[model samples]
Target: MKKIMLIATLLSILVEGYAQEKCDTVFVRASTENGIIEGFEKAGVRIFRGIPYAQPPVGELRWREPQPVKNWGGVKKTVQFGPRAMQLPVFSDMRFRSNGMSEDCLYLNVWTPSKNYREKLPVLVYFYGGGFIAGDGSEYRYDGESMARQGIIAVTINYRLGIFGFFSHPELTRESPHRASGNYGLLDQAAALQWVKRNIARFGGDPGKITIGGESAGSFSVSAQMASPLSRHLIAGAIGESGSLLGFREMLSLAEAENRGLLFQKAVGAGNLNDLRTLPADRLLKMTQRKDVPSFGVIVDGYFFPEKPETIFSKGKQAHVPLLVGWNSMEGHYKALLGNEEVTVENYEKAVRQRYPDIAEGLLKVYKANSDEEVAQVATDLAGDMFIGYGTWNWSDIHAQTGDKKVYRYYFVHPRPGYKNAKTGDDPLIKGAVHSAEIEYVLGNLPVNDVYDWQSEDYFVSTLSQLFFAHFIKKGNPNGFGVPVWLPVRPNQPADVMIIGSNTRLQKEQHRDRYLYLRNVHF
Candidate 1:
């Protein structure tokens, strides 16, 4: 009888301990292709952070393509963010809650509002933009919790950056089974998408309904991924915010890229690929910061790109999925026009004539400015084109003309409310939406960034934009109930992009002549 009483007492202790533990923490879980991962719950969302999507690219793997993640035996606790890719903190606005930086950074995070494995939500995987030099998926401005609440699964991923990601070398290419060296970053992105395809279904994400989107380099990456044969089947639709390697930038050939790699090796006094690979990751990161360092950005590596990006797009060889792309109003500010010259009609004209000496007369027709005010406006417009407008426009135009599906284009014109310049200590009287200003708003994350004195109007703008984007993710079209009617860019009618700003409407594309001039005559 005493022994039976003791057993009852032990059972009571076990029950009490279990109750206490359950109250202390809540655990949510997902079974991935690699392993079961446990996450924590917050705000009606189950968030899994720092899930490794690729084998760490260290030692002999630095310049190689990303390999598959290894299967784990037990449930991996993915409650904390992983180390960010090796990079310098270039943007003051970028913040992180990750452990720190390292080369083992091919990690992706997810946010899901699914109650069980039976629910399948549309997935939106966003890549951060940082000129391919620096960025973290853990930035507060890109939090996916709110997006999950909207009944969509959100994902953010990290890839190798800068030289560590884009470097090309003759020795490295020879060592590659695919005879490719550069574009490791692009390959990393493709691997991440492949991971999404094979593993996201377990997290209540629809593997067939994944939409890839980003701003700046991330936009460039989306374009690259769409162009690459490796990532074609993984994408359902695409959203490019404001840049592509082919849109406004030059891409080095494999040979040129290898030469640049050679120059970097010479400057750094590395004898060979073996020597370079042995150097500390920080050492390589520091070399990328040098102004004189040859930057071999996106290249036509034989493995990643079967052909040039433009050639692929021109022949309708890219992914035939629906595309939604756009840029800000003032992609390049007035300062980009003035440069060293004073803001005068005479100086502006002189600069224009110098830039377009061969066609100065014809160029002035499109960029006509008789007064100083007119000059600033014209200069601002041209600078915007030179920065990102023309390239993004070129992408949308080509895709609309060639792709199997219709294309949706937009021009974001909402300027950030003028606030005291954080650096100058006075209001700069900001008047235009410069590059990357729409990211937070479109992602439904305006509250995450308080750098500007956002008004109710700003929130209104955010709500409408997010709705449009969410609709696009859920359905192929951004048009839906209670939003402004949006029409696709027709094959014949090139203009008619949706204008999203203080007053949202469908405005006919105005500077058609100027864009044509820039496309054909100017640059």
Candidate 2:
């Protein structure tokens, strides 16, 4: 009788423990304008993935502006990521955790630290960069969990890509209620912003405190958004890692975009927009891969962009939000300038003269190379400037001059350590921080990226960089306790750029002459 009672008591204790554990499990939920969504809580952060912000752009909706998401009846399971946007594998660095690839890809993911909507934390909406042709919100480097941990509501959104997002036709323009075609990808982003403004408060985000940020083409989108009348009022601040729409590439007029669309239609043997819409998504994507197909890109539609982005910024008509913008140390390489030739001074001069014959003398003077060793570094600088550095600098200069907001510029120079599991001689020497290298560091996601053998300094840099960004997102200024004092760019003054590396410090801008010279010369 005694043994039986003891065993029964032990079983009762076990059952009670299991029940208590079950009761402790928290299921986080939030109510949006559409409906209530249940998100999973992990390590105190509530994550909602693959929430549709707009209707799927499919069938007749192909090549059209994204439609509003309709209200659903039941509690939709937003646990898994939605399908990524339609894109070919153009970049090797891109890694997606999305459910799959499809045309129905207008979804977004959110990570919030607040337990209730009353917290009203600041929000960071980041757009991925794949030259505006490739990229997904589900990329590991773009994960918002870490940023959320820092008392932010971090969001990543997917917009259309390549032909699916940028194709424009006269038919499309005629059909549009706004009489605008092309820039559907940008339009998708704007729609997502609208959705967030209306619904983010439910997720514990302050709609009035939203900061838009991105890198490369994503950075271009930020500039475009600031200049667009539709999205400028919706953002409190802007962060651009590199590149801008102002000068990275020329924005096409509607006529040019329509002509390109016509060429694409002819190339695919589609007689009209109706036939183009009827084709399968896979076939349409494959057709875009052909060598003769004119690459679809952003257009200056009168709706999204009333005037050129440069003109808007010049006229101080863009969103005068606090701006944080910079580029990496090496956005391009000497190989881009030398091609197959060795990095020799003579070859460098010849290449410069060949590429810029009209301004060769002035260019060589600005990007001077005296010796072979000097040629490699000088050529690298010139190549980087020609590719993106000059444009980024031009953006900062123009914004500082015309806008009333403060501009904080940075120069990321911390190169990644090396691969952890590399063999004796397999690791290549990284010259400098390359383009898109600062994403993980600035997002506090160095640990999420397992490819690099991250060092203590890397973690230090990551923490420091994220702190700067977090402070910027929170208060529109990156200066805070425990971080280096970063000065802002003053109008018509020598701008001080924060050189971020093992020894992060402020340095006066040294390449203004180079950019000024490039600014005058047409390429």
Candidate 3:
């Protein structure tokens, strides 16, 4: 009887402990339109990583718009980051925490502040930039935790890349219900937006207050979304950094895109769509390295865009949402514009004249050099304009003109600290905000990347910058009582912009004439 009593008591204690633990620890769960998902909690934020927003585009689905993800019967655990889109390590700066690389990379990560699934917060959906060739949402620099802490729901997403994402051919176009090919990457973005609309409310985000943002190719994508009829209605606001389609390259027509795809087929010795589809992902990715593989850029597929983006903007048919857009201080390096020649006044003038023969005098006047010493400064401006400046500035110009909604412009001028190691690449950096330098600051992620020695000024900049972003996200305007006063681009007056740096302040657009001249000159 004593032994039986002791054994029964032990069993009772064990059962009580298990029941107590089960009651004490509450797991976070949220239901989507498709199914229920389980996410982890960290530092007061509920994180759902690697949630499938669409089906993996493999085999027959290659080069097609993302398909809907299949619903699961049980709660899906979203723990690990999905594989990065198929890509080569083209950039040295890229560092990822994802599982690896694969064609099955259509995933998105969400960071939300609400512990319960009932609080509807504003949503910020960010896209990673890689010239549309490479980039992943799992990059440490773009982590959404910081933004989530600021009372907003932040999400980062992955889309297809390189040949698998953008390839176009006659056979592929013929099979499409829309009679279009290419731009599957952009279509993936639209599809993701649709998914968010259907499911974000379940994740504690308001469907109406969504802002789409990105840098470089991602920035160009925001502009593309604004022009795309399928996506424009989904966009409530926009944020573009460093690039847009309107500046330099024009969109390729569907037929032109298909012709390039045909060339790709001939170069790869593939006869038809079936032959290309049967090729392994590795084989298709390897072809991207060859010179004969025609480069695929954003094209005017009739489904994505009714016409060219430029034409859409000109006619004021693009999305009439409030826009916060700008580029960095140095989008292009001096060497790119100077070529083999030194930064001499004579060389600078010659280069300008050669490039803009018809508008040399106007170009020279806008990009004026006071002395030989000032050549670098003038050249930097000229070079940046040539690369991403003209396009970005042109975008703000058109939006401010026709959108009627407030447009806030900015110039990211703060450069990163000089590297501690002379061997590191960012040490010999120019005295301007290098391309993508503002990312860490904007996302409040200075601590994650130890590439450079961060200073107090960096933190100060980040605090202000993120506040501006958060403010804009919470409310359409980026200004409030506590935040620095940010004014919109004044109509008919000189275009004004907030200089986001150590000393954050509002200022009028500098060298507006130069951008204007380049706009016409490029035309």
Better structure of 2 and 3 per TM-score: 2
TM-score to native of every candidate shown:
0.92, 0.94, 0.92
How do the residues 1-523 of candidate 1 rate in per-residue lDDT, one tens digit apiece? 9999999999999999999876866789999988899998875799999999999999999999999999999999999998889888888878787769999999999999988866778999999999998898898878898788778899999999988899999999999999988998889889999999888888888999999999999999988998899997798999999987665477788989999999999988989999999999998888877877787678988789989887888899999988988999888755665676777888887887777688777767887888776666688777888777888887888888877887899999998765435542432423677788899889999887767777899999998999888889988889897689998988756578889998999988887777676667524
Over 212-313, each residue of candidate 3 has an lDDT whose tens digit, in order, gives 999999999999999989999887899998989888786789999999999999999988889999999988899889986788878888888889898898
| Per-residue accuracy of model 2 over 1-523 as CA lDDT, tens digit each | 9999999999999999999977776677788888878778888999999999999999988988889888887788787888999999999989899999999999999999988678899999999999988999999999999999989999999999999999899999999999999999999999999999999998888999999999998999999899999999999999999888766477799989999999988987889999999999999999988998899888898999999888899999999899999999889888887887977899999998998788899999999988887887788788887788887888888999987999999999998776678842421322788899999999999989998889899999998899999999999999998799999999877799999988999999987888888888743
lDDT of prediction 1: 0.86
Give me the candidate number with maximum TM-score. 2
lDDT of 3 at 231: 90
Residue 278 lDDT (model 1): 95
Off by over 4 Å in 2: 1-26, 423-430
Clashing pairs in 1: none
Predicted structure with the largest lDDT when compared to the true one:
2
Error (Å) of candidate 3 at residue 149 is 0.6
Q: Using lDDT as the measure, what is the rank order of every candidate, best first?
A: 2, 3, 1
